[model samples]
Target: MLRTVATRTRVGAVRVVQRRNASNVAVQNIESRWSTLSTAEQNTIAKQLEEAQKGDWKSLSLDEKKAAYYIAFGAHGPRAPITKPGHASKVVAGVAGVLAASSALFYAIRLGGQEKPHTISKEWEEATNEYLKSQNSNPISGISSEGYKGTGYVVSK
Candidate 1:
């Protein structure tokens, strides 16, 4: 008796899988028929749909209903497509926002620990100035490195 029940359950599962495949095939057939219709036929169907009252919708032929469905949603049915909107953008924006906030919090924490904000070392400043002067052909056009104080973790280290 138990073995018979187990066999029946397995058969039911197989039937469910087969039903799903059949459903998919039926949907594909509907989509293909809708697509193959000429522009004039589509327009005529759309006009019919637009003129159709809510109560009269059920009166429409299967083909006409299928056309209406196509009009409502391009290719896919009523359900949303597998691919979602703003998925990549949402992830990128979320990650970027989190990283930016974390870095800013880290910087603020580091800055809080320092009593007097440290300035750039005199030797490093002089060396940088020398390098800039040597590399720059147009001194007036280049950025001025002087009169700026370097603070936070960089200065502390």
Candidate 2:
């Protein structure tokens, strides 16, 4: 019984090794078929490439090198383009719609809004400066300061 169990165990281990080696064989036409391969097949190819790279790099076949490079830098998965076709046109249209809506809102508000306040006039601002001077408002470096040259409340055109 012991002999039979040991033989069976050895045979099972050998079978597992053979299965692994079979899977790790270089995939034929890897470039043409890589994208269409199932995950398992792709993984097998990756593993094969990894093993090939573990040796002297010069010993790596052209296919193995190409496969490794593709796996690392191919335009697939996260490296693929996020935008679909006509994405730029869609973005431009969205921006144009928003701008048109904003322009419409702005014109509507301007036409319906009240006139500018009386305080916005240059004469009113000059009066404000005089009042500030009289009231000692902002005495330090301001309207009430000595030789103050800064424009004070006079932005109206």
Candidate 3:
């Protein structure tokens, strides 16, 4: 009987200490929420976390990252200025204007009559060749005609 009384006293003292700790507002709030959750809800949350941990969580490719960002952070609607066919005509007109200006400038330059320098005739070439020949000797050595009236064979010593 005495040992049972002593054990009961110790259990009561432990319960008092636990009650004192549970008096904390933060601890009491967490305890109240946890007590309110059903066993099935907690089990479901645990299963979801376990499945997520099993999934791949490495760095993504550029394409995959862009796709995820666009899906999560897309803007409201179409946000650009619309254009029509007349815009193309404007570009064409600008190009044609440039071509016409260039053609006019070229035509004006051609009509201005630029004189080409005179090229020397073959007579000038013949005189120049003759002058060079007089300055430079004919390098032809001893020779004879078909009638045979010239130097003999150059026999070596």
lDDT of 2 by residue, 41-132 (tens): 78877876776677588755566677788888877778878999999999999999999999999999999999989888999998998888
The Cα local distance difference test for each model comes to: 0.59, 0.79, 0.48
What is the C-alpha lDDT profile of model 1 across 6-63, one tens digit per residue?
Answer: 9999998787556544433433445666666677765655564555434356555565
Q: TM-scores of the models, in the given order?
A: 0.27, 0.65, 0.26
For candidate 1, the TM-score is: 0.27
Which sections of candidate 1 miss by over 4 Å? 1-42, 48-59, 69-105, 108-113, 116-157
> Candidate 3, 43: how far from true, in Å?
37
State the lDDT at 23 in candidate 1.
36
Clashes of each: 0, 0, 0
Q: Which candidate is the best by lDDT?
A: 2
Could you give candidate 3's per-residue lDDT for residues 1-98 as a string of tens digits?
99999999999878745543432222223323444557775454334333333435342333333333332343312422356659989999999999
Where does candidate 3 have its weakest 10-residue lDDT segment? Answer: 23-32
Q: Scored by Cα lDDT, where does model 3 land?
A: 0.48
Deviating ranges (above 4 Å) for candidate 2:
1-32, 54-61, 149-151
Which ranges in model 3 have alpha carbons more than 4 Å from their true place? 1-84, 119-157
Check candidate 1 and list the clashing pairs. Answer: none
